[model samples]
Target: MRRIVQFSTGNVGRHSLRAVIGRPDLELVGVHASSPAKIGRDAAELCDWSEPTGVIATDDIDALIGLRPDCVVYTALAETRPMEALEQLTQILAAGINVVGTSFVWLAAPRYAGDWVREPLEKACAAGGSSLYINGVDPGYSGDTLVHTALSLATRVDSITVQEIFDYANYDDAEYTGAAMGFGVAEDEELPPLFLPGVVESMWGGPVRALADGLGIVLDEVRQRTERWFTPERIDCTMMTVLPGQMAAVRFAAEGVLDGEPVITVEHVNRLTAAAAPGWIFPPDGHVGVHRVVIEGDPRVEINTHVSHPLLDPTDAACISTAARVVNAIEWVCNAPNGIIAVEDIPQAAIMNGLMWRAK
Candidate 1:
């Protein structure tokens, strides 16, 4: 069993912790926490296990490094502290420990991260002969691996579009929803950072390029289009209320153009509820969130995937999938050549270990 330390138990990190505990081949050697209150707690307690696992959580980075685990599953938030995450990953790699992380998401394809982030990371990897693999749901499997795998069935390809359609009424992170994504705000106000020009392309374009490269096509240009819908009447939501004429939903599309046409495209359709936009795509019955890939070719293929459990709804399943995508790849990543790697280079992510599904 490979010794592993989990970092920052957040939305995705918590599930990563669960995955580490569930996998018999991975041993939990340490748990790194940013919160002072979380220090001195048992890893099993942090994960809500009925009994202790002998490994206690700590705030000391040196303590974790001292253990010298084979790999570090760094699931810290990149959107908030990208520089810090980069520095931490660099330090971890320089210590000769391979990494599988959800941070620095653009590192899902390292080259697209520009020279600044990639340069230091590559230096650290080379210095220690350690490799790093970054991934998540949308940026990880939905757009890159899932699309590329589905494309294999097509004899001739016209275009490929990967879509994420969800009703986010139950999604509680008001700060992230309103401030970062510009949801429930006045449409006339300046759009949030995510909707601003070049932001989505900067963050998500790497996956598009990764998928395009799989098809051996070079995108001449990458473009973005955004459209928003407004609420007609005040509606109460678990997170926030959508008042009359307020921002209700948004559609954002990033297209990779080749020969003056979009060959690879990724679209996100998020609604406050089904009523927000009746015309827009919503998950079929028995699902609330759907990650879909559509290939228009000789043998057209459209794959809709939804992760669900008895206790977890579609939204929770989405978060778990994000964590599980990279968590399940830790072994393959640690065994790969020393460098920054992508999903296409790694083995298939096997996530069917403990979760059961409802087939309809």
Candidate 2:
């Protein structure tokens, strides 16, 4: 069993923690808690598990590092604190701990994360003999693995598009939905961080490049397009409120260009509610969210994968899937060579082994 340390206790992190606890091949050793309310509590308490796992949540990074875990599931929010997240992951790696995380989506394609973000982590992995793999549901699977899987069926490839269409009405993160996503803001105001120039490329260019790399095609450049939909009336979401004439939905894409043509695209259609965007794409079968892969090639192909749970909403199910993706990679990452491991480096069997198997 791999000894694992869970960092952070947010939505994704919480799911990662429970996954580590539930797995027989993994042992929960320690937790690095970010919230004051979570700190000093048992890790089990943080995720509502009935049984205590003898692991306490602490904000002491050094102390957690000293636990000498085989892997640290670094699920801390990386978008708002990119550099800090890099440094933190570097510190964890430099301490000889492997990492499989959902943060640092750009790291999904390290070549595009720029030298500043790549060099330090590379040096850390070399210095400590540890590996790091970063990914999420969208950047992790939809655009990268799922898209490539669909491409395998095509005899000739023209263009590839991966879409993440979700309704954020039930997603209860105020800062993310309101501030980061600009969901409740006016269109004329300064755009949110997600819509800012170069941001989409920074976050999703990795997957676009990954797709290009898989196809053995060189990209000329990566471009972004963004649009927002206004709410007609007051829309009170679980976490934030949207006023009339405020931004309620967004449609954006990051395009991978080759010879001035976008050959690979990662697009997102996010709305506060299904009622907000009448024209934009919505999840199939009335599901709240879906990751769709559409390939325009010899045999035009489209695949829709929806993740949902009986107890959790569609968004939460996707969050848990994101957590599980990295969490499931822990053992493989621990055993792999010290460096940044990409999603393609992981075999299909290795990724599916954990999800498909059950204790008999």
Candidate 3:
């Protein structure tokens, strides 16, 4: 069995810890956290485990290194200190431990990151003879990577668009809900231009750009746009004051181009109140668009997917599923020809069969 250590106690980390613990081929050796409050607690308790594993959370990196686990699963916040997390991951890899993570944006597609982030990490891994891979449900799965995967079956294509829409009213986490969908903000909030800061684009921009590149298109420019709204009238859940005609909808769109011409568009929309006027423009009702990959060519194809509600729990199952997928691929990645890689670079058959094998 492969021994693994999990870093972080956040939503994704907790879920991945549970999933890895349940796997027969993988053993949960330890859990690490920077927070002083969680150190020395049983790993199971930290993740609400029914059975106790002697493993205790700790902040000691040297101790974790001594344990010499096969790999470390990292799921820390990517927006802040992403480079710092990557530096830590590189250290682990240099210690000859394989690493799987969702922290570094570069792992999604090393080419998109250019040499700035990828070249150095690649060198570090090479020096340690270790391997690293990163993936997640959204940027990892929902973006053009999946679209490009589907396009492999197509003989011709004109344009491709991928969209994800969901009702975020159920999300009670104020920080996540607010920042993610632009909630509680006026329409005219003097925010920076869309995609300039990379907030609205999320980390999936590279996936989209990579997919377009794989399709033989030389992308010249990309465009991003966002719209936000609030409850026009006071609603039960929202406390923000509003007499009427208040903003209550938000939409963010990103478009990829070839030769200054648009070829791909990725959109994310959220609605908090009744699905009304502007709300319709954000997340059109009828279906929760988890993923919509539309290829317009020959036998024009459209692929729609909906993540199971329980599996969609950002804290637990959703991230666990994605992490598991990434973790299970570690062995293959370690043996893969050197240099940077992406999800599509690995064989689809291997991913599918490995997932099935892990399930059993």
Candidate 4:
């Protein structure tokens, strides 16, 4: 069995830990946390598992490395300054531990990642003879994989559009909800332009451009546009009112062009308030959110509107599901050629297996 260590105890990390615990092919060797309160707690207890495992959380990187696990799953906060985390990843790689991560969006497009981050991580991985892969649901799965899945049905393609629409009211954290929907007004805001446009473009842009290039289209430019909506009065979700006139909704639309004509467009919409547009509904079906992917093609086709379960929170599901997919691909990514890779480059069998394993 491959021994694995998890690097966070947050939502996505916990979900991944659960998945890892249940996988017979893998063993949960250790866990690391930045929080002092969690340092000595049992991993299972920290994740609220019914029983405690002997695996204890530690803040000491050296101690964790001493365990010599085969791999480390890094699912830390995305907005946190990535330099330290990247350095940590480099250390893990240099220790000869394969790294599968949900951070580092530019791993999907190494060329887009500036020198400071990518070069060091690459060197570390090469020097250590280790492999590194970064992936997740929004930027990783939904944007790239979903678009690629849509393209499978096309006989002749002109453009591809993938969209995600969901209710953000269920999220309690103002900063998280704001970042999800692209609201950047406060100085303390973690919801920066990166999540809004730069990062999103970096993650999905390569896939969209790749699809265009695959179709023999010479791409010219990529453009981004954002929209924010607010309500004049406060409104309550099932739990509480978010905030009056405080970023009720936001959307980021990115388009890739070939010689100034649109070839691909990916749009992400997060709504915290009630619907102002026709056919857009909040808590539709008494749920926190809904995700729909629509693809426009020569003949035009669409597949699966994955709606959030009322029993399950959408944001949490999205985050967890994305992480699960990434983790499932660890072995494939390890064996694949290096540099930068998108979901499209992964084999269909592996992708299907990842989805099936997640479902099971």
Question: Against the unseen true structure, what C-alpha lDDT does each candidate score?
Answer: 0.81, 0.87, 0.67, 0.68
Question: Candidate 3: deviation at residue 85, Å?
Answer: 1.5
Could you tell me the TM-score of candidate 3? 0.85
lDDT of 3 at 75: 78
lDDT of 2 by residue, 1-360 (tens): 788999998889999888888888888999998778888899989987778988999999999999999999999988788888888999999989999899888787776678888899999999999999998887878977788789889999899989999988888887764688788889788878988788888888878877787789889998999999998889887757899999999888899998988888899999987779889878888888889999999999999999989889888899999998898788788889999998878886786656544422
Candidates sorted by lDDT, descending order? 2, 1, 4, 3
Candidate 1 structure quality by residue, lDDT tens digits, 1-360: 889999978667777887787777788999998887788888877766656789889988888989999999998777757788788889999999999988786787776777878989999999999999888888778887788778888899999999998888877756665566677788778778788898788777877877777778888988888888888888787658888888888888889999998888899898876788778778877467889999999899999888887876567678888887777777777788999987767656443433442321
Residue lDDT tens for model 4, 1-360: 778898887767887777676666678999998888988988887766676778999988888888998778888765546778877888888887887878776666454556777889878877877877777765566666666677777787766776676666565445444554544243334555544547566656755665566667777887776665655556666324545545556677668887677767767767654542223434335555545455666668675445344556777677668677667876676666543445656785774443334323
The TM-score obtained by model 1 is 0.92
Error of 3 at 117 (Å): 2.3
Once all C-alphas are superposed, what RMSD does model 3 give against the true structure? 3.5
Q: What is the lDDT of residue 95 in candidate 1?
A: 91
Candidate 4 wrongly placed segments (more than 4 Å) = 177-200, 236-241, 275-291, 305-311, 334-341, 351-360
Which candidate number maximizes TM-score? 2
Q: Of the candidates numbered 2 and 3, which has the greater TM-score value?
A: 2
**lDDT over C-alpha atoms for residue 294 of model 4:** 57
Task: Sort the predicted structures by TM-score, highest score first.
Answer: 2, 1, 4, 3
Point out the higher-scoring one by TM-score: 2 or 4: 2
Which digits, one per residue and each the tens of the lDDT, describe model 3 over residues 1-360? 778889887767787787777777678887889888888898888777788889999988889988998878877765557677767777787888877777675567656775657877788788877777777766667674568666877899888877766655545544544554545555566543332466544455676677777777877766677665556565444423332444455677767877676688777665664453452643334544356678888778887766555445422334565676677675576566544567867786665433443331
